[model samples]
Target: MNTIGHTIKAARERRNLTKEELAQKLRVGTHTVEKYESGEQIPSNQTILKLSTVLDIPTSELLKKQNI
Candidate 1:
């Protein structure tokens, strides 16, 4: 099963962005990004919106979690 972290990681990869690059774009610390990808933390809704924008994916897509 996929989690939000997996979705975030996949989307970031699809954009060819490293965690550091994504963190810079999101104005967050690299460790924060790492935590998000590692499923150790969950981003706020505001951050999720930012992720959707930065990743060029829909908010709904970011919300999805399933076997992909």
Candidate 2:
């Protein structure tokens, strides 16, 4: 899984939101939410923050972890 998948999963769990509910809030298709969770696609920075806000996660946590 990709960074987005991990982040999405964690955030969703934190907010107790299902994929369908997240999709509704994002106003995107459920498939889109699935894709993000499955690492099939990565959203832009703006969308990432929007997702973090909606999911109540920090942007850093939602972003890929940097290698030391």
Q: Which candidate wins on TM-score?
A: 1
- Residue-level lDDT of model 1, residues 1-68, one tens digit each, is 67889989999999999999999999999999999998888889899999999999898887776332
Steric clash count of candidate 2: 0
After superposition of all CA atoms, the RMSD between model 2 and the true structure is: 2.8
C-alpha root-mean-square deviation, candidate 1: 3.2
**lDDT of each prediction vs. the true structure?**
0.90, 0.80
Per-model tally of clashing residue pairs: 0, 0
Q: What TM-score would each prediction reach against the true structure?
A: 0.90, 0.83
Worst 10 residues of 2 by lDDT: 59-68
RMSD (CA, Å), each prediction? 3.2, 2.8
Residue 29, model 1, lDDT:
99
Residue pairs clashing in model 1 are none
